[model samples]
Target chain A: MTAPEVVSEDPEDTPAVLADEVEHVRKTRPRTNEDDMTLVGSVLGGLATTWLLYERVLPFSGALGFFVSWYLVFLAFYAGLTAVNRPRAVVVDRVMTSLVIAAPSVVGLALASTVVVTLSHGLPALLHVNFYTHDMSGVRPSDPYTTGGALAALVGTLIEVSIAVAIALPLGVITAIYMSEVGGRGARLVRTIIESMTALPSIVAGLFIYSVFIAHFHMPRCGFAAALALAVMGLPIMARASDVVLRVIPGGLREASYALGAGKFQTVWHVVLPTARPGLATALILGIARMVGETSPLLLTSGASSFLNWNPLHNPMNSLPLYIFNAVKSGVPRNEVRGYAAAVVLLLIVLALFLLARLVARGRNRG
Target chain B: MAGSSSLPTRTSLRVVDEVEDVPRRVVARQSTQDLAFTHGVRSVGFLTLVIVSSIGIFLGVQAKPTLQHYGWSFFTEYRWLPNLDTIGIAAAFVGTVEVAIVALAIAFPLSLLSALFVSDWAPAWMRPLLIRLIDLMAAVPGIVFGLWVLLFIQPQATHVAHWLSEYFGWIPLFKVHTDVHYPIWDQAPGFASYEGSAFIAGIAVSMMIFPMATSVMREVFSEAPAGEKEAALALGATRWAMVRTVVLPFGRSGIVGGTMLALGRALGETISVLLIISEAFKIKWNILESGTATISEVIASKYNEATPAQLSALLTAGFVLFLMTLAVNTVAASIVARSRSGAGTEL
Candidate 1:
């Protein structure tokens, strides 16, 4: 198709043939049509110019500098091309549209790069079955990559997270029930406190548990104490999320139960809770996700262990996050690779939990 | 047949009148089970409050000895030498703010643009997936980001730091006191000086908090009045103009609240900062420099090896961080609540 020479308010300057093509349509939608060639051409031109500037003209050599300058040059090119036929306002709008679209792409690129880099760095450690089967009990940081693993940390994380879930889930849901179903002055106060508690630094939870249990109470640093710290961090998150979920449960369902002569408790048990079950699962998953990767809390409450200790209450337990922290901080390249591998495991677990939550949420939406 | 219909109608009318005539003061009688359940829920709620509050109380109590020993000097002293019986959080506080500022500076614009794009520019079929992508970003553990920063980005970031210091050296915040001259495209010996700066730590943290801020802003942007948006479009406003005038104004409080929430998270961010920063116990304003200490990072790095006295000092630092985050979170929550009500948007 022939390009429009100049699109303007003056009738003759506009393309009459293109106008005729769109005339039969209502044309009520926002005018967003643009030349495909201009978009492609500007981007290519920008890349070429940036390469020339960086390699031939400018002294800049880093990838970051090149990409940053390329983006700026691309915007300039886009503006220059669009302004050829379009008004200044239209040119500005087009440039902004490109920018808005570019922002998400940049974010997505960063995320993708992080995943790729992490996998590349950690994949070697994960190749060994030993990585999943053994603990670093006697292995030194300078040992070969296959000599030790994070099996103890993996088991410890599962134990501690489950205990935290067991402690916090019921209380969080009930607190949500209180705020949503049993409205009173105290509920309001409790709600405000809970909201603020959600902001409590995860480290503070560790400090609290350390002081109260390990320091003052003379308790051993065990996975149970770490679990308690995780519970402290996870409780407010679960309560807040579950509160929102419960509040979204339809009131009509509650009234239906009440109209059937069911008491408040029975109605809540049979009606409200059932209706919000999927949402509650989401809250549960989210709470787990929030606490599962908490290193600071585990660092303080559960001292790092190099043994495969199954019992959470009896000994120092190592979770995945603490394992990563220790390994990375060990300043050994081999150990740091193992740490990255454990981080990959942690990321996968979180991803799986979130996917499950999403599945439940989707089912609820369809139902 | 007429008598039968009239009798039923009279019965219905009687029922309707009975319902309408019922006193407003009438209440449902609670069964014993209902009463017990309500009390159970209330008590559980109270238990949660107790559990959460005990954190604050425990910190306050554990920190008491250290606070008493240090007096106001705790706030004034910059060094943390517990071995010498000297400790303070003044520098840590400044470092926390510096890192948070750098994080928010990088995160805010990115989140705002991403939210706007997702809400306005994305095709309907792609919206949910985009949202999920953002949410997934949030689920990535901080340790992973820290690893990425320490291993991958730190080297590349050193170059950017050098460039910034070269161009913006007049701004003290970007200045580094190195003797190395700029345009050093190669990784010179002096480049190692830029490796563990607050700028690098902040960049890692910015990624960690970006998803949260984006989700909040997206929620508010979607709640912009459809009528107003359409009216602006109908009035020949360009798509960008419509967004600038309608969506931006409507989402203003969301931006502020989201920024503050992200700031709160950045301030308390532990693993990433701990991984990326080299510990220094001096007040430093230059984020491009390599030595600074944040409250959470200090606590994390020191807690394992600290003496009881040092532990108490660390707890005091934790207490301060807790208060800072709590205040930021409360204010952000209130702003978000107000905006939600004003927009009449349900979660």
Candidate 2:
């Protein structure tokens, strides 16, 4: 090949000339100030409206005040940003202006509506220390507020969920393994069927269990049957989630394991399963959350009990969902209060599970 | 000649050795069979299929008697009084369909707009906060939403009803009834009671499904390829025009799938409908006037007191609900499959 071509450099070229060109380039670019401001304004306006509405309309003033003050602080920050004329100044200006315009009226309307509702419905019964410690066996609508608590319902819910997890976890995990690791044509067919089952309604699961255990076998409604019904609801979700998590495991890890003379099962257990553990945990917790809030299945299978029933097979179990359903159905003022309390408790339980699952997922992601 | 003779002798010896290895292979196969038998994943998968099938089979068997008695006639008959031996699911079916349609009509546009706001219109800093709020809305239980709407929204709807009558009395839908006993017009003009009406039930169901649809649509819209949007922008399109032409077309199948899934959810929703709809089986076309029962509501309300015939009728209704859900789910799955295949080729 011929020798490489050589080029001569211009002696007049200087660092100052390059710097000036870069600066000129930067100055010619169009600024996004107007676009960002409009966006920020609209967002602030919407949030201010929603926050004001939710707060003033909340059943408790405590939550309302907490949120209102929270939004105002954010509003102030926006105003400060705008005053500083930062790159994001237009965004801040828009937000502050929108909040100033929208917050008062929405908040006022929400507060007015909430007051009317509170007066008509009265305050939800205070859940005292004993509310978590007592059973509802002796409680009546006309009885004093000290009659009993939802301790039994709490215990029953725990037991039902525990048994449901026990049944669902291994089955779901194994099914997922089959779908992701060893799945062939037959496995695909099985997976399709399971996925279809995931969308079956809670009521249908209940009716199926009710017909099988109660009508045909002459069995009484019990916590075990309820747990079984919940397992039906939880299984497909757990299996599908687990399958997705398993499929997402990098192929390199599996190859590394196989190169170490590990068998298929060993590779799956030691390498793949650990990698997907967080997602699996999330799936399990989600299953628990889903079953915990289900009322219809528990209604048909577990029935309802005022008192605690530790024996899953022998007695009707008191669960938060069942308790809420019964209280609402009773249509007594005291019962409605009880319903709200139970609802709050149920919501807390599901929220706790979801948060825990998310934490585990985040931890695994970092690793 | 001596080397050739040695080679033939070695080959004969190797052939003899190969024959001996066959029995050893059979023994190895038996051990592998034992290994496979010990592992339980395959067995567990099989067991799950069996259990799930048994549930469906058991329900079918239990519902067989009702099916045999009514055959195909049960669906068309409207009356549901079992003590008098008159039972049909026609009115309940109509109410169910009507409520689902109306709720979808109300929820679809609202959710689409909300999704657009969250995905495209919101500021970068605000998007996460808005998404979190949407999540909170999704997390609120159906029963809680039903209670809130019943107590809060119903009163406002009544006011709107009165306003419509006062300002636009010529409309048939806004005609006011003056009967004091019925109380359609007796109270404050707008404050009509919806104690057990289809309209209230529809609104409650709409609220229940709105968050799900919005979240799904938001995800689909956000996932649209950036290049397509950029191309539209480069060709001189407004933001709304770009969304209408590029984003919507890309997300149409996804939206349809989401809506169908929501429809399935609405069909099976029991608690909200039970709280809002009336127990009556009568069909009233006027949305603001009266309540009509749905299949889910009827089952929830009457399951405890139902006789064998009535119970069978409910089971039949359950079967119908199952079929409706299956159809919707199948359609959604097919759409999802089609989109996935299309995406694969494009990628």
- Tell the DockQ for candidate 1: 0.41
- Across residues A103-197, which tens digit of lDDT does each residue of candidate 2 receive? 32342343345334533452345446666788889788545556677788889999998998899888988988887776667567768878777
Give the clashing residue pairs of candidate 2, or none. B158-B190, B196-B278, B197-B291
The per-model DockQ list reads: 0.41, 0.19
**What tens digits encode model 2's per-residue C-alpha lDDT throughout B31-137?**
35324732467778878877766665655666688877877667777777787777778888888887787688867876776676667667799887666555545
lDDT of 1 by residue, A59-152 (tens): 6787888998998999999999999988888888988998899888988988888888888888989999999999999999889877899999
Structure candidate 1, residue pairs in collision? none
DockQ score for model 2? 0.19
Q: How accurate is candidate 2 locally (lDDT)?
A: 0.69
Clashes of each: 0, 3
Worst 10 residues of 2 chain B by lDDT: B1-10
What is the CAPRI rating of model 2's predicted complex?
incorrect
